[model samples]
Structure formats: C-alpha cells, structure tokens
Target: MILIRLESKGPIFYYSYRVGMGYKIFKFYKFRSMHTDADQMVEQLKHLNQYANDEAQTIKTKPLTRSIIAYSNHDHILVKDDELFEESEYEQFKALEDKKAFVKINNDPRITRVGKFIRNTSIDELPQLFNILIGDMSLVGNRPLPLYEAEKLTTDKTVGRFLAPAGLTGLWQVTERGKAGMSAESRCDLDIEYALKHNFWMDMKILFKTPLAALQHENV
Candidate 1:
C-alpha cells in the first residue's frame, strides 16, 4: 500500500509498494518538491524551450556535467550547481542539488508555509523510518524515482540493480539533495554511479551521513 500526499512539500514524493517477502504493503515517503501544476506547466513551456534552443547558438557540452545557467524559464528547471539546499537544518542537503522530478522550480509557487519548513529541515522524511523497519528500505541506497523517470533508465543496464531494495536515505539524497542548485537528472546520474559501486562499507558511510544531513538547516 503506497501512501502519497499530492500536497507534500518535501524534496521527494513518498510512495510505497509490497514486493513480496510476506511483508505488508509498506508506506514509503519522500519530499514533494514539484509544483501541483507541474505537468501542465511543462507541457505549456515545452515548445518555448525548443524555440529557445533553436534560436540560440549550440554549445556542445558533456552530459551530466554541472551548470549554473537557470533552466527554469521553460518550467523544466534542470538541476544545476546553484540550487544549493541551505536550510541550515539539512546542511547535508548542500551536497545534493535542489531539483524535482519534472519541473524543478527554484521558488516553486506550490510550496506552503509548513511545506517550506519541512522541505528545508528534511523533517518530511521522518516517516520513511517505518519503511526501513519493515524492510521496504535500507539505511542506504539510491533514492527511488517515479515511474516516468524509471522508464528513461531502461537502457542504463544498471536500473534494476539500483532498484533492488528500499533506501531510508541514499547516495542521491545525502550527496545530491542541495537546497537549490544542480540539475535533477545530474543527481540521478550520480545515484546511478553510487549504485554501480555500492558495498556494505559504502552503505555504512551513507548511514552515518544521513543524520548530519537531517540536522542541518539553511536559509528558509
């Protein structure tokens, strides 16, 4: 039984499912940073982004490399290095990039007052511990993504391995979840890297880093 709240203001949206093992359908949680109107907004801005690209000079760059250029003009706010999570409470967020699944707006209009606080402090992630206890998640791993993003990874060859288990906090969360800078896909790519090189000691390292990440706070 995956639990979800469309109104969540955290960094990732919480979702859960039962993958056998005699376990009940457990609840998975994540911060919801995407705008409630994200889908429509992206669709509306798609052609604009295309036009912008077509009218501009093409500069070839490496894939997944960090950039500071704001990509939100088209509502597809690509995670760059400028979106550092500075909530002070979640200082570890500094290491991560501030991005959403689809439209990664810097100052998303959907965020509520309480939602902002929860997102910044990462308090919104508290409920996931239950998932950890129930074996739905581990202390470390890659953060799960939406079905849409997962579909894009079909050719990555490493997607199945990354999705092997649930993670309380993962390489992506602890390392790439900054308050506001960094592209969403770039962070996901980093997660793929971690999954490829994962080990027990690496997992432990992430576990140790999670608390510190949570305890940090930035400018709300």
Candidate 2:
C-alpha cells in the first residue's frame, strides 16, 4: 500500500465492475498497478491487441478495463450464430471485434514502478481474498472478466465457463500463463474445460501449481 502511495496519487485499491459467473456483475478488486489515468488511456493504445487471427481478430496495443493486469491475473470467444444477437448487440460486438476482445501490452507504459513490482509478484491480487470470502469469487475457478471483454464471450461455446466460480487462480493461470500462442479462444477453452470437469482433486492440483504460475517471467 505504501509503495503504491509513494509512486502515485490515487486509491490504493482498484475496483471495477467485472463480469462473473452466470454473467453476474460484481466489483472486482486489486492493488492499483497502473497510473491513475490508465482507463482513459485505453483507446489510444488499441492497435497492439495480439491475435494470431485464429479467426482474424486484428491485434492492437489493446485495452484492459481492469487496472491491475498480467493477462489480468484476468482477460475470450465470439458468437457463431449472428441471429442470437439483437441488432444493437450485434453492432456492439462488431465494434468490440474491431476494438479487439483481448489485449495484453508487452511493455505497457501506464504501469507505475511499484505497480510493476506488485503485478510481477502477484501481490496485486491480494485484495481479492476479500472477494473470495464474501462469495464474489473463490480460491479456484475461472478468473472474472471486465465488462468490455465479457460482452464478447456469450456464445454457447465460451459461455460455459461461467458455470464455475470466479477465482484467483485457475487452469489458464497454471497452464497457459506465458505461452506465446495462447489465443483468446484457447483461454476460454481452458476455462470451459475447468468448468465442465473441475473437481476437488483438480482444484487442489491447480492450487498446487499456482505458486509456480504466479511467478511469471514477463512484463505486461
């Protein structure tokens, strides 16, 4: 907290409405790991969102709505049948596709020095223990999503992830954290895998792997 204070002027905890299980919106918390103006800076950096064009999503610098980011600690899929979306929703999804559904900047300029330390060490996620206790999240499950990112993932294939609780660590965190080819669809696949097949043993395995996964090797 002191490091965050010393490095910048803002609330030490960053809170935003994150889409959770069953598409529920909840206040997600994290240590503030970026400059105060980070949210406003999103649009300017949209061109860097990374995509292999698995389906041709233009990679741009990208926008992360939640402040503390390391693959978001958090960050998707598209609807197959266009008929499912209402006209307004379809238009928004198109804009979102153009905006890029997933974004993780390689060397984001908005992060503060202390922010960088907390993020790399996964210390920024400590605040979420409260969410776990209060039932907004859990110790093991899929990570929650920011509204912008969640809006693009309601298709039948990807929406299954919401069956499990949101968590601090999950399948993707342990398995795909730093994989260069980890696409948005692949992340959702892991999440869905966990949702459909998660059990006590699996959760324990994930919990065991978390410490290792949390020790990330790159800057985001």
Q: Which candidate should be chosen as best, given TM-score against the real structure?
A: 2
Model 2 agreement with the true structure over 98-159: per-residue lDDT tens digits: 33666777678898888888888899999999999999999999999888778877777778
- TM-score for every candidate vs. truth? 0.53, 0.79
Best by lDDT: 2
The global C-alpha lDDT for each of the candidates, from Candidate 1 onward, is: 0.50, 0.79
TM-score of 1: 0.53
lDDT of 2 at 103: 71
Global local distance difference test of model 2: 0.79
Q: Give per-residue lDDT, candidate 2, residue 64.
A: 35
Task: Give candidate 1's total backbone clashes.
Answer: 37
Q: List candidate 2 segments past 4 Å from native.
A: 52-99
